[model samples]
Target chain A: MNLLQKFCTRINLTKSSKGYNVSVIALLIILLLIGIFLSISIGSSKISLADIVSAIRLKDQGSNNYRIISFVRIPRTIAAVLVGCALAVSGAILQSVLNNSLASPNVIGVNSGAGLFFILTAAFFPVNIYLSTIAAFIGAILAVFLVYFIARKTGASRMAIVLSGVAVSSFIGAITDTVLTLKPDTMIARAAFLIGGFSGITMDKLSFAGVFILIALIASLVLSYDMNVLALGDESAKSLGLNISRIRFSSLILAAILAGSAISFAGHIGFVGLIVPHVARFIVGHDNRLVIPVSALMGSIFTLLCDLLARVLFAPYEIPVGIIMSFLGGPFFIYLLVKGRRGQLYD
Target chain B: MIKLEDISSGYNKITIIKDINISFNQGTITSIIGKNGCGKTTLLRTASNLLKPFSGKISVADKPITDYSDKELARKVSFLPQLRSVPNITVYNLVMHGRYPYLGFSRTPQKHDKEIVDRAIEEMNLASYVNKNIQELSGGQRQKVYIAMVLAQNSDIIFLDEPTTYLDINHQLEILQIVKRLKQMGKTIIMVLHDLSNALSYSDNICLMEKGQIAIYDSPEGVYKSGKIEEIFNVCSQQLAVADGTKQYVFYIE
Candidate 1:
């Protein structure tokens, strides 16, 4: 009896450590469903869950409320979800490739590069949204390339990469501010884009962004094992039969594409890319395969919730989704920083 | 069986190791020993295909190493480079990474693969700390975990570059014991060792190199008795006989 008790105790401990992962995933999914429903129902009209469902099924006879729900709100909700997932997955990949706790699209200057190009396109050319998006994508890629080329001496050093990214990002940001100051009308337009809101997203734009996001997401998932090996350092990874250069290049490219697309559509939504991945890592441990997918899901949920709060908090005068995310993500990030400094996550 | 035929290898525009011709026998432990800057590590890296040789060719079982696909080469040979910094990971998962070539795109380990990893962990006597993060382990324990990872590769030939740099005397011998056991299991083991005594005692063959050239490559007794240790290592030794009738070389300090 005693032997059986001891055996069961050992089994229980092992199961508990493993089971925490499933529970966290389950909780996040539940939160996501709740956030989705609340987001659809909590607009200016304040429709009930039944009306939202009926509207979704196209079985309701109503005023323009049904059209508002189907065409406008639905597209915005999906844009929020897609943008959030894209940004979060980009953050997770960048952090792993840089092997630093602070690496993200915002910190590394990729977002700033996209923003600068976005403003330039808006000012110089006719603001065809597609052209602006393409310009942003090119700018993001160029920025990452410049940072990588400058920082890499013999091989990629994490500190060098991060520091170089900061320097280049700040330089680009300074130019952007100078340009914005020169043209106040351009600044107003750019400011609306920069602060980040889902108020005006259309189904066509959402579908376009969705395709690119899906490609990036699939690419990230496929290369997740390589990402795990990369975290062990280049020499070790090479010895373990990984082509270090190929892995690094592919991960960086994927991160750039995802992040650039999100910035193009939503401007620079700051915290979703930076915080969502860290939260996922904390919950799921450091396995990239699990971290990538879970972070995507969590990011989508986080963005949806933030957008819902953005609509309801100041009712009639909507706040930017980015502001709400910062309000929520800022405190959470500080807690992670403290926890990391205390070495709580190292083990 | 591993053969390096007159290989010249180095970094870009700088030759580190030149004209190295040697063959490591199967089912034996071979040690490469040399003074600092003699290109011991460069030779190991070249032989393991980590560095591209500027000239000459290396073959495993008569097939050129460069001809093999990455996965194919991994299946035949495993390497453990000199330790720099330990990443944050657990011992169990670290060992499981060794089976990556076999698992391919599926990152999850199968039951049999887990059994092999568990056996490797047990062999290293790291069962108590199997669940603990690798960064928290002592230097010696961490070294064992790394060796266990290479062992979990289940390859016929293994190469290690300076496997005992940070270990004390006891852990050093413990690592040597593990290498000897690997030799007994009919695996071809080649390593660069800094400690002359450990190299002589544990290795079946010794290759002493100086100035990017082979000083001597022979049996331990042959190399020690050939009076070349004095030229290669700048030291003299006295032959000592133990009660077990095993001959040991004791180096005499000036």
Candidate 2:
């Protein structure tokens, strides 16, 4: 047999998965770096490898290439990566903590929560990045808590949580729409925010949300081990001495921080949370320790690639990255359903 | 090793198990047997700290159970809940989670933890299935995997709620054998069992419940002599000698 076949058979023979998991993660990290390079270089302005290197080094700050890379593309690229990492990790955590595969930041009303609050903040308050970020975080928390409490009150089954999330999401979405209808002045900002694109992104907008997302991502890695236990069900988790409520609450808060912060800057970017984690699990199996970091890296790469496609797919007219995401995510989701692996994976 | 006093616990406001007081001795197998909804599961859950008693005091190792942290309590007792999702994890990984309470902040499995997991997998005869996804396993095999996880916990007290439920006769016997071996290892075993004959055959003591109250807590012989099985279950009981030279209680509906 060839070496690849030998390795595949070995993997099936019940060997330690750490070896394969580590290799998979390392490979993804390398791919992510390549993806970032591609995202930076392949924009409408056609910034080359040499230009990106020089721009990042500030070797020729006055050059037009440096100006485009530094001011526009750099901030946009970083925002894509951060937003991707945050949403994907948040979805992974929510899926495990809620023990439902359907649980995602978008599916569970967390994104709409942040979106609603961001809209309200943008309308009433001055355009303060910090205030909007915090408001979005609080809004995400409020929405998640609402969904949780509603589900709990109505029998906290797995389906109940998802059903409650749908109910809460539409309600929050309607509120946001109504707010936009009342204040036509906010439509310009709300339009781009709703579609979710990298156009006009700035370092100032990403700064606060970036910090929150980084801290929340680190916290998620720390808590991933406990999350594995939590996925075993409440009774098993509690029996293993896990504080089920504490872990679940902390996980939700971290997820909120992630989804909330990302949407605070990136707008209601959908499908990254819902799709990337499933893909990550497909690659790395179900260990959250492996799933979380893999999701983070894969999320960054997925968004970066999607953003790249959005930039070049139409030469003069740039579409919102969220539109491209829906175009891809809708088909991928149906593919997962057609594969019939969902039951085997989540059961 | 575990004690409960004036325990009343249930879902929401309604009390299912009321005014129960019982203690489990170490190095023995005690099976809780009762009709459905008689709160046998609740009593087991309450004692294991999975369900908080509405009003009661529980002590473990002569100290209040509340005094111990969750990790400490986990190290003291391992519980196999009746309801659990079949997580999409390999057998080895799932069994390793039994060492959660023993790990430090890093949560990495040390050599000691690995050795225990190895022994547990070996004990459960799960060596061949270590790398297989638990979802791929049969009902009996999955039950073995879960039991291996509990064994890897290595707690002084073990709580299993219907460990043999839904398994075929062969697998059920195998699980009972493991429980027997656990008692031989000097660990306390508390389980809720629906099979009266199996409980009588396997456990040193049987706690019979009726209407959420402990009707009898005694040796299997004593419980059988009390004629409570026939009275409560509306069944006839016969003591027969098996080829193994042990008396087995067989229950049949009249």
Candidate 3:
């Protein structure tokens, strides 16, 4: 066989192999360990790796340093990892459902919808983080339904759905800007949160969002095969006995839940959803069973690295996680676009 | 066996098919041929339960099609629409999806399911391209992969709309042969064919449609002798004799 033939065959064999799952799990574990270490070491204090491990083990040499590492840095790190995983899995699911390369929550307006609701809750309720999270979740769901309804009339064209999402998101964003502009007292605080950061996260809020992300992640993994089947298109899926409407609706809801929960806590971080899944799919192949979990791990690692940079690169007066991610993810996205245009990645 | 009784189906308020009645028997090949906009694809879609009928009933194996759960209906009936763009997927995975009705939450293909998929692939002579991505193959080869997928469903009844679209002459014959082979295996196959000679040669029964209703549904000889072809297709044609009692139509362009 030619080299291309051999490569294609090897990919096909790996996709069908049982050992595929084992290898992915192993990679995920390694990434998790690396992410944990990076999250602990990269902060204002510049703790040593040994000190960080000792602090995690509760065998600290001093109280002040231990408290800083355990209470402050650990929660932020946990929040970053969970939110990263959530966004990545959500992106994978959205791409599969819409069958488009550019169907991430940020691009398709799911995040914008949630962000608008979050802004509303912040403006009106002022002090209820939990209520804001719920409001965001509800808003995300409503936006998805609106997009579905508008696009359904056009026979559910992927391009039409994406365009509708963009239109609706911009409209909602304009409304959010109007509200923020009018409420001068809350404007700066809301803008800071909107810029996306995990710096001020508490253990309670992290744990709260973590539970939702965990459940949604498990649900996404379980439905990964269905998502793969769906990529074959709705007609083929129906012939295979899949309830197309049910699967699409449930998977979209699951993705919205994960993304909405993440945005509620971490604000609207970009690129984790858009870039991580595409990169993970390139590494692991398009079998969602592997792609979903692998993307989650890759997302965690990418976000941890970006968050680390955000904290230490400017030292004290930290950069927003969103800005840092944009710096890294923007170039990666451009590379993907160029490769896709050349027909190297897609073919 | 599949039966459609006075079926009327279409998008919302615009009815495309009007009270159409048709029945297809087990272990036989049937073809529905009609002009553009005559509702052949719509009829097939409704019969396969992809589109719900505005009125009338479709029954599969003595039960209403709508009454059967999605999985239950899939095990009994399979439908392949007209060829469009094939995604970059392997032939093996495409065929394995045919066993999706039997898969549960675990989504693991059983040994028996794998065996069935392999047999279907072998039957289509796609073993060489089994591991090749579908988009890398020729149009005919891709069509065969999809046909193999439907066959792997192992349903008693199968429906295909314009299965020969985009295929070369040789591949068209290859596909017709595979459909014939499926019939020999006791499958009830219903397909839409644009070529009258192919429909007349391969199908045991032919349903010639005009506008939104069936002009005639009977044996090929019966429909040919009824002078309905010229009436329906607006083409002048004569049936020529072939060995083994099969006849071919020669169409004359005015």
For all the predictions, what are the DockQ values? 0.51, 0.81, 0.69
Candidate with better DockQ, 1 vs 2: 2
Q: Residues A171-234, candidate 3, lDDT per residue (tens digit)?
A: 8889988988887666765676578888778887777678888998988888888887888887
* Candidate 2 lDDT by residue in tens digits, A55-132: 878898888999889888889899999999999999999888887777788766787898888888888985675687
TM-score of the second chain in candidate 1: 0.96
* Residue-wise C-alpha lDDT for candidate 3, range B164-217, written one tens digit per residue: 988899999999999999999999999999989899889999999888899999
Measured against the true chain A, the candidates' chain A TM-scores are 0.87, 0.88, 0.86
Which pairs of residues collide in model 1?
Answer: none
lDDT accuracy of residue A149 in candidate 3: 76
Better of 2 and 3 by TM-score: 2
DockQ, prediction 3: 0.69
List ranges where model 3 is wrong by over 4 Å.
Answer: A1-25, A59-62, A149-160, A337-344, B243-245
